[model samples]
Target: MIVDSPKIKNLIMSYLEEKKGKPFELAVDAGCGTGRSTRTLAPYFQKVVGIDVSESQLSVARKCTSHENISYQISPAEELPLEDASVDLINAGLAAHWFNPEKFGQEAARVLKHGGCLALYCFSLVFEIEYKDKSEELTAAFNEALLILLEFHKKVVCEVKAMYQELFSAIPFKDKQRISGICEVFPLTVPEIMSFLQAICSYKEFLEQDKDKATAFLQDLEKRFLDILGESASDALGFHVYYFCLLASKS
Candidate 1:
């Protein structure tokens, strides 16, 4: 159950709304795993399609989705199973880092109507836990925990760290813009934050390499957070995460 940042979604929609000349008809959620990002498009578009390469993920997405106008399909991001000049908006939420940028760009260019928008967005994994007085210590501890898993990061991970600067260049759209330093704050408990961290791909890779070491590292991270707070481990804390978006429009 991956939950996308609502503020980021709202930001993307706002930009698209500002730039569009006509009503939004069809929106595509490329690499829409579990349909979380797909569901967000329902209210704005008459039709929304969630595309993914994994049936297993689409199965969960289907089960979770209740919007009748929203549908799911199994397809790669690079090869969208959609007609030419059909989609008004194509959004890939956090999932674009795993895609073949060149092919995906060509497909996006083919499917997007004239003046259609393609928005790719992702949040910084390196975020700080905002606690009361010990905010500095807590943030440092949390970031340090993430350092243990850096060895497992894939090459695509670097694109995210650079805030999609390279991917923005690869988007094949003549009219495009890169927006960065968009910050959003969320309230989450230490355990909830841990759950989010564990869901990251690098963490899974770290676990595969050494399960016992990974488990120990996870446990230590929680303990460190709790010690810094000097309170209940389940106590909610503020998470200040920064996000970046690359917006491209077809000419």
Candidate 2:
């Protein structure tokens, strides 16, 4: 937890002070992949349920060491098993985008006790700065690679905006809910950045699923990154701007 990496446990701890040492009666983690954040939630609540739709993912989560208060279940974010007004807080860490927001919002409202909190943390690979003082070719290549990601995800994968509205204007927090939209630039080194990408995206799957297009895209990416970043991605470290942390409440 003390690691200065972009670990979710570390981010959860950043908000620990707000927890104010108040013990939670019940808590849950939506899409708690591999229990990275599930272990963190255990200590705060009398009981914590780490839920995921994928039993395979839950299997991985269960393999991790956990506190007696911690548990895991296979369930979708849109349909949690808990009753209304049953939980003190619920966290969605870098995994909320995979949910149906209209359903998720309703379930969250259903499970949360009066004045309970709904916390989330998500980041994009868009705001990265690398290739500084590098050769022109390498720098240009890096820029092109980054741009390709934006083009593909934003232009192609148009359904990813449920969680990153950048503001709470049309969010579904209840009328009496208290919401805080947090934006922070957390600096990350190369390995940490790669791990973040692995957790949030699936470049390998994309490449495997459509080898021809993926190969072309990657070839272009390699050329651009090499041209601008001075070194191939394998050689140089990548950095990303980790920026969103939204916390809301329902009363």
Which candidate should be chosen as best, given lDDT against the real structure? 1
lDDT of 1 by residue, 50-97 (tens): 999999999999999999999999999999999999999999998899
Model 2 Cα RMSD, 1 decimal: 4.9
For candidate 1, what is the TM-score?
A: 0.95
The residue-by-residue lDDT of candidate 2 on 4-83, one tens digit each, is 22454455444443542355688799988888777777766789899998888888878784588888888898899999
Give me the runs in candidate 2 sitting further than 4 Å from their true place. Answer: 1-21, 130-143, 150-163, 166-199, 202-205, 212-238
Model 1 misplaced regions, further than 4 Å: none
Model 1 poorest 10 in a row by lDDT: 1-10
Best by TM-score: 1
Task: State the displacement of the C-alpha of residue 115, model 1, in Å, after optimal TM-score superposition.
Answer: 1.2
Clashes of each: 0, 15
Q: TM-score, each model?
A: 0.95, 0.69
Q: What lDDT would each prediction earn against the true structure?
A: 0.85, 0.60
